[model samples]
Target: MTRMSSFRMSAWGWLAFALVPLIPLPSVAEGAAAAPVLQGETCSVPGLMDQIRRGLASKSPAYQRYLRALLREAAVTLPGAELQAAFERETDPVMAEHLAAALVARSEREADREAMQVVAKRALEDRDPAVRSATVRAMRRTGALEKTGDLYERLMRDASPEVRMEAATNLVEDNKFVYAGQHGPATDTAVAAAAASSDPKATAKILGTLNTEKLGAEAAGTLQGLLRSDSAEVRRSAALALGGVPAEQMGTAREALVSLYRGERDTGVRKALVQGIAQLGFASAVPELQRLKGIDPGMAPEIDAWIRALETGLQEWELILREKQRLQQAP
Candidate 1:
């Protein structure tokens, strides 16, 4: 019986040993295999171009978007000929626009003046309004419009309001050739059209450009008219722009802003008025700023701060003017 029991135990042990391979065991270092890493030739320019070509040929919209992103990333690093070739081969207007945008982006990033001029000229002829608008912006960024003045004038008259606005903005900010004696009717007309656009954003952009270019006196009449606009945003932008008006035009700008402030109900417009007043250092406005600070609870702290700053600024300005007068009379 003892021998039989021992034999039975040995048989059971053998069966357990045989089943060990069939049962799943906890993963061990030596038993696990590492996943293979993917290797591709995406690092080289030619390889990227190949990818772009393939992506453009694909029917998937997602692939096209990916290609656009890749092109943007490559920018001026890609050969100009390659980009132009791609643009030429592209049949879809939208795809062509994307390719054009990539070229423009490259031009802007590298400050490639020649490339920008070429793209601008081509973009102006493009059937796509978006492409034309983008090219106008690129011209503005690269200051290429300064050289291509006719393009600016032509773009200002574009059928699309968006394109016209872009052209107007570029003309105002980038047209360095339109100097003191040469400010022509074309520029005046473009500015007027931009300021008169139904799109307040476009109008606001023009006003802001006027301020940035320090051409306030040139647009004094437009600024005055804009201050009376029903759109509070237009009025606010006009108020801020008043700060940049030429010294000869400050009085007119100040009067318009103060008059608008008196009847203005919007807190935002009122704040803009304070800023303009502060910019002008109009000491006489202290009383009105104080009054507004008392009544407008939403921006009381801001108004109060402006009041203090204006007071200090006006005092300093007065002292400088008095000293200058005293020195001039010392002869």
Candidate 2:
């Protein structure tokens, strides 16, 4: 047998190939056969966003609105009145309130008055702390943040501890201004050092400190050295740390990533490479990704999706560049 066929015949390989192509292969049975699919909205699967959208847009009122809001946010909006009712029936006050706001955003025109009335009702009276929290979020989304500020303040002082906590968290989160100096110059200095530090461990520690712009220039400069780290742990950390590195450095990082992918046989390192590539969103890595496809076809869909998104982005960049050149020449 060929290498691919040989690999496919291994225990894990047999299991991987024996299962359904579209649906996930069954997990290894330890004792009894799995339970029958007598399901009504089972969340056992990982990628149920599409399934939930379809189910929610149906006759189940309570489930419909809840599913709609969830699906809508995922870029797969469900339709119908059931979703609206589902939003209302949500026991979690915060969630109900969120559904209320989400509905308002999705709805349109004076024709949606009746639906708006339901949202308004939830905003007015929902005992669940989560419902109340969702209501505040909805109001803000509707540009009624100022109008709802008084209500949010009341929630902050609510009798329910959950309500108070949600209110406080949202208050801090929505404002953004409050978190300004929480980590200032010292944090920035540490991040700068980590990005350029010669010691891989030191670099990893510094990279860990930064949540933002710490990855750009320093990541580009450190790319070659990081890929050559003597310590596997440091190399793995460096790979992860390169996530969110500047787009301009994507080409350079791509080479290091491929090297890491090949040289580092560790599963953790492989996963890190996958995640970092996803973060960098680089198109130049398409050829490399295509090469990796031969090694593991199971991840083909994800790899293809990444390649498409990157290529589309690169195409748009090219168009922008062309337009810039056109403008520059016109003068």
Candidate 3:
């Protein structure tokens, strides 16, 4: 027998998976022959909803969870319009939250305009943080690409750290998905739109991907603005991202990176700034890298590696002389 070792859920199925270990599922009558498992059957949405309603009315957490598990299973097979309607009419905010996620995850209508519109409304208007959190997933799953970018930029400043982090992560991850498709322009557009909001995650994603020099006079000006952003994460991300831009694309980025190193307040961000400057592989950065090594002996190894790498890139003749000397000495 093949054993189940792990599972992945793209949507809301985990709700059931979490509870199934604790509660015993309903058993078939012992005297009656067990009904044959049908291969092509789907759960009846209305019938299951009746049971779910009853379970909720029962006011037992266990029973509600049992019903929730059942709903999660049925959500896979439920009609999209019907699921949307169920969500619209659901009275309990928690169940409504789950239903919205399921609606976006299942059926062909996940991308329906009306579906995304309602989910966006709930994400904005709902006072419950949990409901708002779930709606972010629903919004990402159901909303159009441009709209999703816009929503994510707004949510990046959300009061709830969890929601803010989720928005930030999704902004980059969703951009990455466009990259996976090899839709290069789409990725650039998505990141550029959100990056303009000055959110750290989106800014990093955009900076790593765009030829910022092509943004007319914004050129290195955009990067300079980013380094001065109020958010340390944004500044840190900008420093790291600037390292990724090919030097030919913006030679000035190396200067920007090195300039930030001395004044950067956060030790971790300073290290990232050093890493960015190191990645640029400019020999001029060696002096500062050396200064950092002297200031913090703990940074010796990384600093030394950067120094060696920069020396090799900038002074290949030095390596050739050392090699030639070594060969003569070998005799």
> CA lDDT of each candidate?
0.61, 0.50, 0.57
Measured by TM-score, the strongest candidate is 3
Q: Deviation in angstroms for 108 in model 3?
A: 6.7
Tell me the spans in candidate 1 whose CA falls farther than 4 Å from its real position: 1-125, 147-193, 206-210, 282-302, 312-331
Q: Please, what are the lDDT tens digits per residue for candidate 1 over residues 173-291?
A: 64333443144343344456556566666666655545333443566677778888888878877787676566787777778877777778998888778777766755666786777
Error of 1 at 156 (Å): 6.8
TM-score comparison, 1 vs 2, better candidate = 1
Cα-based RMSD of the predictions, in order?
A: 19.5, 22.6, 9.8
**Better model by lDDT: candidate 1 vs candidate 2:** 1
Pairs with steric clashes in candidate 1: none
Compared with the true structure, model 1 gives a TM-score of 0.51
Candidate 3's residue-wise lDDT over 192-295, tens digit each?
A: 44455645655555454432222332434555567887777778766765665544644677778767776667776776777677655567767868877765
Instruction: Say which prediction, candidate 2 or candidate 3, comes out ahead on TM-score.
Output: 3
- Report the lDDT tens digits of candidate 2 across residue range 120-202: 45654676656665665564323232323244434444555554444434433333342331333222333333433344444
In lDDT terms, how accurate is model 1? 0.61
Ranking by lDDT: 1, 3, 2
Error of 1 at 175 (Å): 9.1
